[model samples]
Target chain A: MFFHIILERNMQLHPRHFGARLREKLVSKLIKDVEGTCSGRHGFVVAIMGIEHVGKGLIRDGTGFVTFPVKYKCVVFRPFKGEILEAVVTMVNKMGFFAEAGPVQIFVSNHLIPDDMEFQSADTPNYTTSDGSVKIQKDTEVRLKIIGTRVDATEIFCIGTIKDDFLGVISDPSAAV
Target chain B: MSGEEEENAAELKLGEDFVKAKCLMNGEVSLILDRRLEQLQQLSEDPLNQMPQVFEKSLQYVKRFSRYNNPDAVRQVREILSRHQLAEFELVVLGNLCPETVEEAIAMVPSLKDKGRGLDDEAIEKMLTDLALIKSSSSSGHLLKKLGFGLASL
Candidate 1:
């Protein structure tokens, strides 16, 4: 899921960048520092939409650096338990397949896949149904429910399942064309 | 930690922080990214090349999954879904998936069927129908544009 929420950060600026483009420097620095970083509480920060506020700079006596509190609105992608997500399959193996829904990595174990589908080992690995009407392989889009999530300081890993109704292959790159 | 509560979509238990946060539909995310991309293009000589990996992947995901491409259609989807008195999370899920049947919608986000929510099968059907109409109208308009371009090229 994606959220547009306001977040606050204290930015440190070197005294050399204190001139006319101070605001520009701060905004660019914030983008460089914040975007792509993940926190346990906020998930992944995809982009900095806009800067809400920049507090007065407080100079540090030792290093000639200044700290300014910055508030910004950003788009974050956080997968929650029981939230349905559409993800692209990236790999397939005997144990399970690894899929990516943006920054989050999900593993849908073989057991969690509907029992009818069997894994086919080949040059292009995939899980296919008996009749072969349905297939899950690299690049296939699937809608799966996140059964669990592990949040690290810089990453999030999810355990997903497609065993439930309305959850399974959404689109196949091979078949679509 | 108690933070890892078992929140189920069936009852719309989306944890504490998430329950109040503003949820963005796929289309809205795409729109916001598109505008940001344009801003980057205007500001720098080479823009996309410097984009963060997260931004690039998110841009691709949202652009591919967004059901409605036009701003007007995006706004209309929110407007139409909001009328059903859906929570932000539910609204975005319904908008993103565009489920064809009430059953599918309920299966996808079961909170819509919670007894206390007071939504019935018929009302859910009506909502799905309205969403489908928006999708069809927008897609047909897209098809017409493609046809016009083809004709002009010939």
Candidate 2:
């Protein structure tokens, strides 16, 4: 879900960034520093929307660097219990396959997979049905529901299930969906 | 297994070899075996080796049983049904099939119908529901359709 909430971060600037493009440097630095990083409180920082207000830069005593408190609006992606998400398969194994919806890594345990789909050990491990159809392998796009999630300092690990109705593969990437 | 079931099991022994081969092709134990076979197939069929014919039949077996081979699914079913009083093989069947309805669950344990209010009849239903394994009969065609397995006929 996208939120227009404001977030505060302490941004430091080098002496070289004190010239005409100081604000541009600060915004670009903010995007690079925050995007893709997760917080225990919020979720994954998707994109920096706008600068709410940059606090007056405070110069350090001996280092001569300026530290400014920057407030900005950003979009964050967070997976909640029961939230359905479409993700791309990253890796497939005997346990199950791991998928990523942006920054969130979801694990759909074979237990949580529909019983008809069985795990196959091939050059590329995949889950397929008895008829050699409905194969889920690397790069396959899947729709799954988050049953359980554990958000860490930098990453979100989720236990998802595709066994439910309307949850599973969306389309094969090779088929271009 | 009951008296009649025992006789059926004995009768099944006649096709023991055929059954074992079929199981290895598409049963729970094949899940692990298939993984190894896949790796071996890839290695043996390398650019230099190019000897895939060595396990060509096995490759087809792995493909056929790929979906029915997972032991983890059985393990999960076992964990969920451990509270109930049931035999090991019965649990295996339940794990493998993962019946999606109360009617189907009962079908898996049809012997229970004769026992008159057999052990927590509602447990299986609740378990399947809670695990989100029940196929939504009402929805019909959806995910399976996108995968080329339409539900129109079913």
Candidate 3:
């Protein structure tokens, strides 16, 4: 009788033990859920939800709420001062040709065109320039090295020089192509 | 194994007694050597040999750590190590055990204060804080440390 009475008293003193155990189980499940979602992923999709100043949203991933900080990867490209880059001709004008490569676009002045090429006019195609030195057509590949950059209110102008190895027509069928 | 033990064995074999002296001063020579051995063990057990690049470079780092005095050498090694993809386990193990030689290499680089006669401390502090935040928020802290930023500050 005394042993039974003592057992009952111990159980009464620790009445919250069962609830605590249940809570622990729930927390463990939450951790696993979070870890399963966030682990081994290359990128994250963030959802912003709020009215004004009061914003409440959960970060969904393997990294739990406790580990609030997450890592992100960004690509940054820095070109050398005189390094040559291959680009595609986007537009042609009497002054020059516009070429783009990666995140930069450059204008090659008419004077910079190879000496052997001759510029011709056509109604259907608009304008054409061809020289044995450079075979340039619509969407022709050319190499240009950045000479200067100017940032203005309207647009950023990148000036480039079109002379050097791997700087000319890359799509010529007669050449290595 | 710890990083210090690996350092000793690699250093002894490479005949880099100079590094040993610096390690002694820092009281971390043993830890570094032991971690080096541990890395070797981990590499041997790795199934895909995904760690060969990391291991090879780590061995080179240990060897160079013994000889590194000038900032140029440190910068070179840091660049090489930063290119490779290292596992989290390897990173965690290696990040904790930087060699005294690397510390010396960092010291050799001219501080921002020494770059000019007068400088704004606020700008420098902001720059340092930004860099620190970037480092801490990065997934690969090991890569940052390999690039020669002291781990203590991180």
Candidate 4:
């Protein structure tokens, strides 16, 4: 009777041991699948999916995906040479003026300033129109050329030459009319 | 010494069997191998080997005009490097051997190839970003000329 009890106890331990081994195998497989799915290089293109605004999911492969939140922002422009661009003056200085064209920021140098205008102040240089027909003010709308570009860690600087025939202040007829 | 004595010494050193084997190797049956061996031997004797000379020439060319930092300058260098096979080889070697001189040359290769065809806006923007990384003033005119672009165009 004691020998029979010992055999029965061994049989019970066998199933428990088999179940634990199977569980461990399954867990390892799951961990491998997760890790393998996430391994990818920075430049590799990923398909984006999922519902709008909740969070965007990146489709890494057929088996797995990752998700991240998106931040909303204003429009940004990445202009190139010979591109016709419109910008509003953000700041004016003796050397040049800084303008925002969509998301891109550009500088128009003093040399590019129209020849007809004399700079009134060294600290805050104001220019008069070449024909004396218009007085250019701050926050003026202008068309520009992308002559040069410089990109830094935080910002991109585009240099425009006002010497071109097409580049200058835009006349607002609605304000006059 | 005497011609007959020299001939006898040569035969003794090489042996009759050795001469027979040499003749068999040089025979018409193996004419190609014999010719190749002769050519190699001649090259070994030549004072100025062509490959190393070509490498040295290329290095000198790169050292002379290594300014490719400016956008306009980069454009010029691209034109020059693309045109000349020797210039391209030099550019590659310069990048490998004297990295500092050839760094811009290495960066300019892709840009030159990219500009050969029309690129999308994003690609052009990326190219502009890539261009900002270089800082050299070497003339790439010779390379561009080799690529067949007109000097005026560059």
* Per-model tally of clashing residue pairs: 0, 1, 24, 17
In terms of lDDT, model 3 sits at: 0.35
- How far residue B140's Cα lies from its native spot in candidate 4, in Å, is 54
lDDT of 3 by residue, B3-87 (tens): 2223221112112222221112001222233454575576587522432232233233333222233334333433333333322
Interface RMSD for candidates 1 onward, in order: 2.4, 23.4, 26.2, 37.3
Ranking by DockQ: 1, 3, 2, 4
Task: Give me candidate 4's TM-score against the actual structure.
Answer: 0.31
lDDT of each: 0.85, 0.57, 0.35, 0.36
The DockQ figures for the candidates are 0.51, 0.02, 0.02, 0.01
The model with the greater DockQ, 1 or 3, is 1
> In CAPRI terms, where does candidate 4 land?
incorrect
Candidate 1 residue lDDT tens string, A1-177: 999988999999999999999999999999999998888778899889899899999988999899999999999998888888889999999898999988889999999999999999989999998989889999988889999888777888999999988888875322211
Supply candidate 4's per-residue lDDT for B119.
Answer: 39
Residue lDDT tens for model 4, A86-142: 466777766778876533567888887767765566454555665655544576766
Question: Where does candidate 1 chain A have its weakest 10-residue lDDT segment?
Answer: A168-177
Candidate 4: tens digits of C-alpha lDDT, residues B1-154: 1221222211122222122211110011122222333554676874224222222222232233233423454444344433443223233222211112122233223232333444344443443333223322233453342123222212
- Reference-based lDDT, residue B3, model 4: 26
Model 3 C-alpha lDDT per residue in residues A1-177, reported as the tens digit of each score: 000000000001122333546434333333232211211111111111111121222444663332212221111122223334456677776676787643345787777765555555443121333534445656776546555555443234567765533345644423221
Chain A agreement with the truth for model 2, given as TM-score = 0.79
Give the Å shift of residue B133 in candidate 3: 43
